[model samples]
Target: MSTGGGAHAAGLIRLLQSADFARAFTLAALGTGFASLLIGRTAGSVTLVTIVIALDVVGAAILFARRDELTLLRFAPTSLLAFLAWTLASTFWSFDRASTLRGWFELLAWGLLAIVIAHVRDTLQTVRALGDVMRWMLAISLGVEILSGILLDIPFPFLGVAGDIAFGGPIQGIFGTRNMLGFVAVMALITFTIEWLSQSISLRLSIFSLTLAALLAVLSASPTVLVIAVAVGAATLALALVRRSAPEHRRTTHTAIGAVVATVLIVCWFLRHLIIRLLDAASDFSIRADLWNEILDWVRPRPVQGWGWHGPWLRGDDASAPYPLNVINFTLDDRHASALNSFFDVLIQVGWGGLLLFGGMSVVAVVRSWLVAGERRSIVHAWTPLMLVALLVDSMFESFTLTGLGWMMLVVCAVRAGQSRSWRERIRDLAEGAPGGHGSGSSQDPLSGAR
Candidate 1:
């Protein structure tokens, strides 16, 4: 009996540490975070929390089991850790300690999940996992839209879907809003494109996935989608050029691309009104502008340290809520869930200090990823930089990056980027007396799958 019990325990431990198990867990975590709104709405917040807690427990166990092989130095990005630490520190000064603590805990939960996936799987594996999740998510979203709009011809209030597909939709699908759906579709498009490029999935499936993503992205009718599409398309072209350039000329290519992007952005900013009208995003921008104005009014009072890190605005319980969010909502005469801008959201939450930390984290992550992608020979290397571009550009329009799936993706990309190029690697190489460290070898290119 004792032998049997020991054998069973050993089996369980081995199973948990297996590569297949890690991939599966990655899929589950991505799916949960991406589908959080649908889960929360359908199964209730309690169920959503329960699922997250369960995943957290499993992630902790897996990390613990693998602790011998993993070092703290290489665990996460320094900037990411600093930002998290600042957010945690904000609890002391937060308007509502309870809410702040909850927000911080949720933030840690998603971050942990991302960290685990980053440690367990390489970039290509992570991308493939994301591809699987996005495919299912996009398919189900289309199915739901069809059911609500074409077949039933009624709104799915439970899912926040307005059955608008029949009328050339602004369909929400399961993401709770057109903007969210559009965001997911864009992410899917990126993932599917990577999958196709990497030859990870069948050509037929890749084609279907791309078609599905494009279809939903259009049907969502999100103005943000247009901007994201243009940014991502331009980025794709730039990355392709960088990849094809000779090693010596790559730096020149990078500089030229940077200058062009900057000039384009400046031009867009100056012609913002014309572009807004062209995209029919005037009303959306106007609404966002008004809310941003109100948010600035709140941010002025707590410029340095802000009102503490209460993520999404507290809903339903005004009395128990923090000062500025409830106050802002009342003042605006609208129940604004967030500042609608991630930078502003961070600024309002943890103040200037937090915003700086957040900005540093983003910039470092993107720069590292971009450099790695440019130097690496594999197509999969391009995924991180492209996704980072999408996320950062989208952050200007939505607060999604502060929490949930967006936050997870950001952390995963940052960790992957750091793994490929970081101070930690330099220090380790110096310690081992290996000058210049390993240079673009197979060891360094762990993410370079199949190629």
Candidate 2:
């Protein structure tokens, strides 16, 4: 009787230590943050970002306190460590001190979240959790967008801060600008596609959600977002097709089709200047081009470690270069924010060494995820293609690395890599639980065949 009681207690403990708590906390953190983004007066303020970061930190602390029950910290592979180092170096050399400091704090919070996610959950569950968080975030963003459209006449609470716009219709959101709204909508669209492929819920529902998100994206009218959404969507679909093909036919078909599609896209982009034209539609595109050139010129003289943190732009007037006047104008003007491209911004600030280290780390992360997906048949495998496509799309027109979203996605991908399982393991678990294996009599053997 005592032995039975002890066993029962152990089982209860195990249940408590399972992934559900971590998943719930993650969803809560994301939901609150999205809500704040949609409704908070200070959309990008430290106060709002702080609240979410605090919650994540608390969640991580709890997981660490119960470290014996979690599996995430043990799975910190070498690539992740290298990535973290690169992130730290970037943080150290951030051109905007305040913005960079905020970014560093956010990164630490997310790192803790990643550890918790890895410790308590497997890859399939991680993807499912991410899907849930994104779904809720999308729903909230959609509600906010609709509200913005409807409440055009009166200052409707949080809508006031976003201000009024005249791009065919009112485009107001907590993000305070049409471009940011469009970017967020594009992210929603990607999440919608991922959820669709995972079949986490009904196909009909996924389709409906995706349609709504796409509509919102179009209404926002950011050409960059629209073009990226299409490109990433296409790439993700193609990769999915390849990944799901029969093993014998997959390699040849994937290679042939991938090469042809890539060649066609590259040819069109170069010959017709597809991307350039799309970017030209935005009023700020010219500014970005000038800015990129300015950064290049600045980097030429001080190639290594460039100018220290906040050096080039801050010392705009004094810096001698072809684009110094442009730099001075950009720095003095509040209308133009930091450089529009993240790579060039970092390159000018941190030089080749910083760029290579950070860029190499990002590449390693992508390669690791791909390799892991190849060995697994989980929802995480479905995530890899979408994530890669999204990253590529983001890199083209925006300073993706500067955004919190980029790090968030990276943490999610790393956790997925550590938690993914082999196809055989998934199959066996499914088979043993098809209602005929052992029933309730083998409660103690739930994972008997898993290993």
Candidate 3:
């Protein structure tokens, strides 16, 4: 009777960690993502954000209770907590203390949400869930763009619509900017390619996904994203080749990479002037150069803690730098907020200390993610790292590191790539043989694995 009762209790606990919960939380995450693109502190959007936080709260509760697969320590360890703590502390020094404090909460909340996702997913489910999110987001974006451009011929206020295709658009799609749209397309291209290479989807679907991603990328007309796409594509191809090589020849792959890096460094040193000239050839970049010069002057005074935790390009009354018009000598009522470089944005917002922390975090994340992705040639290995690369590339031209999808992506990838543990994890280690846990008992029969 005791043995039967124990078995029944275990079964009940397993039921609490069901796939149904996974599905629910996944959709909740998607909804939060969609709502975050809006303009405001409006109640509706706030409600959606609350839903995301609530789901995270519930997820953490369930996993913690089950002693199933919770990995809070590995997911958000000392570095992560330190970063969050510092960010929160900056509220005291912010120009607008209330806003900065709120930002801290918002960022931490998203980080928690990421931990929930990373702990819930395994390798395959991670990829599949990623696929579902990107596929549907892209599909919906296409529909919305078409409707705004052709049918309604007006912007959708809720989607943060900038303008329609009738204007020779730099079409902003649902993301509210041409560059952001291109960023999504680039990610889709990477993910869809992985799906294709992995044979996770039908050939026709893969081809269609590839074509759609390409179309969106081109139509968005974002020079930065296009350039980044080329770099990422080259990297992907190189890594793919590395994966295809035999295990015995894998060492040669590292040798080739080292050689290429050396040659590139040598060439860069020899032709530094020409490289500068080539970079200067872009007209828009020249404008940014002019502004950056002025931005440098303003940052000189506060090189330690910075102007405050305040971010974005538009410096209001209490901003660290001069107004965009003052910086660039351009006479336009509209303003450019970000420094066109995320690194500089961090420098101006939080100072050298913040910059070092953020920059270090970014570097560590990319390296960790790269290692994880290089473990195998499968799309699973490729997907997360490619996204990290895209994030890195975009940060060069946009202050994306502290905002929206970029921040969320960083947290998820970092947590997933990490390998750490808490004391409570002993409970998990002991429960490894249980269902929903990962250990030697996992998926020995490929046919029995979850689809």
Candidate 4:
């Protein structure tokens, strides 16, 4: 009976290892990633969050089972490894060991999710499946935002469930903050735009969804998100213009547009306070400046390793400092003081090495995605460059990395969507093990594989 039971168990494992099961697993991971954001801080720990965590585990298992079949990791840069090494090294000297450890753990989880997404999704069908999951996820969030806005008693509408309705409050559909909801909305907008452009679905439906997503973004009222949306839209239009002039200019046009957008965004961020003051909406700018300066001062003394993970930049006595205009109406805490910019947050906690790793990974991912898209010429390739531009633009003024759910979604999308290899590369992969520079199949020549 024991031997029979063992055989049954093994059979079940094999069944779970099939393509259909793998697809389901991927969907589950996406769902979990989405759900985790919705649940926010109330969901408790990893052990307590059974459903979402289970999905994450299942997704990880599915990828591990088929690890040998995919070549996704070959595209990742060695700088990523260096970044992880730097993060790990900081743990030993972190001023706040607990917070640092927690951050490191979260980073590790994100890295695993990225790898799994890249590995398990190898076909266009899988890519479509992933995209579908994203669409549905965004749709659900949009629906909640609309519903909550109608029902909630808050001024912001559909937000401000937790505590005071300060600083735009929490959208609370599944995330902890309004900013998180805004990020998700931005992501949804990007996906919807891609679908609309690709003509993958009916034009009417695409337009409706895109419009709905844009409305949701407006309602979320995330200033950083608004900035990203405008920048991405402008970048897309510019690319469209350049591509119209010459057919061969498509790749060059996208690259040039991306560079221009990045440069403009970086410059704008450096003068964010001035820009906001000029616009007569200096609230967020003032708050960001206060936090930025404090974090910068905190990090200057320990440039290398940082204060070590969630390191305390502010003490209880520091809470009396003036709050940013945006959050001035609400009660401020020391924690809020240190939680300004994601880039600065990393710099203060993980040091310059961490910043380099974080920045380098993003650049590498964007470039690699562009190169792959140039070769593949598929919807994903087109979508990735646009999405990367959006993310970079958004990161300038927002702390997306610490936003939890949205960050996970971005990482998953980036890994899976950006993993598309070129046709030539695919052919080379298949030919690597063939005999006499050709496969033994009586169907086609070795060179035919390149096509």
Tens digits of per-residue lDDT, candidate 1, 136-255, equal 888899999999999998899989999999999999988988998998899889989989988999999999999999999999999999899899999999988988899999989999
RMSD for each model, in Å, please? 2.2, 8.3, 6.5, 6.9
Predicted structure 4, TM vs. truth: 0.75
Local error of candidate 2 at residue 21 (angstroms): 2.1
Query: What overall lDDT goes with each candidate model?
Result: 0.88, 0.56, 0.65, 0.57
Per-residue lDDT tens digits for candidate 4, residues 157-240, read 323334222333334444545566666677767776667666666888777777766665665666667677777778567745
lDDT of candidate 2 over 262-294, digit per residue (tens): 897789667655556655663566677666776
Return the TM-score for each candidate structure.
Answer: 0.95, 0.72, 0.78, 0.75
Candidate 3 displacement at residue 48 in angstroms: 3.8
The full ranking of all candidates by TM-score, starting with the best, is 1, 3, 4, 2
Clashing pairs in 4: 37-174, 38-174, 38-175, 100-309, 149-158
Index of the highest-TM-score prediction: 1
Off by over 4 Å in 1: 1-5, 315-321, 438-451
Evaluated at residue 73, the lDDT of candidate 2 is: 29
- Evaluate residue 43 in candidate 2 and report its C-alpha lDDT on the 0 to 100 scale: 49
For candidate 1, give the lDDT: 0.88
Residue ranges of candidate 4 with Cα displaced over 4 Å: 1-10, 40-43, 46-53, 71-77, 122-159, 162-173, 238-274, 277-280, 311-334, 413-451
